[model samples]
Target: MTATPVDTRPLAIDARGLVKRFDKTLAVDGVDIAIPEGAIYGILGPNGAGKTTTLRMLLGIIDPDAGTRSVLGASNPQDVARRIGYLPEERGLYPAMKCDEAIGFMGALRGLPLKVGKERGRELLEAHGLGHAIDKQIRQLSKGMAQTVQLLGTLVHRPKLVVFDEPFSGLDAINQGKLEVLIRGLADEGTTVIFSTHVIAHAERLCEGIAIIAGGKVPFTGPVDEARDRIPAQVRLETRSADGPWRAALPGDTRRVGNYWSFPLPETGVEPLLKALIDGDAGILSLSIERAGLHDAFVAIAGEAAARDMVTRGGGEAA
Candidate 1:
């Protein structure tokens, strides 16, 4: 018997120039995203930004009009489908089916036997605090519970890569936190987790790297820190008086925001400005700063049109 060697490359997904269209509308345009093994990557964009379309093409559910993609080191995504688990943006489950049965069915479809699926389903449900609902029908579960079960089904097969589309949608704050913990744990165990969301906060908190998609294209793809760097740091300071000699020392675009006066931190440094403010006999009530978050980064990376798109859409989805 001959021994076959395993390929130990760190890339879990390599895709470039992936384009897709529907009718006259181009859903995805020249988007390129590369995900490393065991990474928690987020595809972030607003509604109708072609996020779902991109994921579909990457998973091989739909063929791209142009470009190439490889999943799990294979040119054909279907060949590695069993190694990938997916939870779609839309809810999918047999309403009449029992919770355990539903999960087992999903597992079975990925090549696990019925009996093994059922056994694993029961164990997963129990381990995840859903043991009481072992015999509960899908229709009887709460919307959040149903969503969680579907997520579990996506994992029942123990896939190497898990793809979730809007997984945080419709979940309560507590459940959302739980889902984040779960996803983080999965990556710790060596499973690559990729999820798409319009919520910059979710991506900011959970992802190591992100792709900011807008207007059917990805404008930024890199580590979260790099993305945050796209936006300038904001300096927020509070003082005993709003107007004084400090005004002359203040940076050009200062504005009052709630309790603090804020302005874009100069690239030169904050220490010089701090010295100027202090030299002017400015009474510094409290000196603090607000770093640019992913929301700020999203606006900077996505640009004006996408910024309007994000803000008009509430800057985040319900999740």
Candidate 2:
């Protein structure tokens, strides 16, 4: 008998048919995903879109009503608890704890020796440009500084996988950019990073693969470019005259919006259409093609009304 070749690329997080309920409400429904090792993956959706519930399920914080999952190839997350790092959306820290001590404490919970944790914590804080504040109390730091300390704590043990929930919620523009760099750095160093965020721009710029969940269902998943392909490209053109023979060259579904004529880019290409318009003596004022973004993709996958509801983060039991 021939020996089979081994498959070495195992998924860091494998979840299938996950379902959860809170009383009569369906918090998560039939969710499934395979997060590859050494990749940056994102769970993106509006607030209460079942994103938090799904993360909770994956971490074994809350048992799923149905389906199964594995974390770091283990059947239970607790089995590999020390190998995974998690930063919940709700920030937590002892107000009186020193900056370095807070980070060490977080590592201690994951079984890292307190002495090692403290040393590593100091190293991380210094590297992150907070060297002067290492001994400051958590309550003494600014909001952004405190958040950074919490993030450093999450990585003090050097877990194989890390998850951040709404990591950008309160960050300023400069800090947000810094955090993006940090996440990328982690992935470059061979750590599998997974995060949940309502902000689509972060996923667009950082994630290699993403799952877009809404109303407890994932409408789209896979590569970022693939998700964007769901929405057709559009063209916007404006002419000095609204009525002319050139109008006939436009797509049948074309419509006038504001001062411009908008229509879907056709299969034949815009070159032919532009030539026809010029031949008909039309004055082309302005023109350009608009590529779809994540927001547009979300709206296309989930209906406009549902997307609107998502933007509002409807209901009190948020995901």
> Clash number for every model?
0, 1
Lowest lDDT sum, 10 consecutive residues, model 1, at: 310-319
The number of residue pairs in model 2 that clash at the backbone is 1
lDDT of 1 by residue, 24-135 (tens): 8787899999999999999988877888899989999999999999999998899999999999888879999999999999999899887888899999999889999999
lDDT for each of the candidates? 0.88, 0.88
lDDT of 2: 0.88
C-alpha displacement of 150 in model 2, angstroms? 1.1
* lDDT minimum window of 10 residues, candidate 2: 310-319
Runs of candidate 2 exceeding 4 Å displacement? 1-9, 238-246, 257-259, 274-287, 314-319
Q: Once superposed on the true structure, which residue ranges of model 1 sit more than 4 Å away at CA?
A: 1-9, 240-249, 256-260, 303-319
lDDT (Cα, tens digit) per residue for candidate 2, span 197-268? 877789989998898888899877777777887877899998887788888899999989999989988888
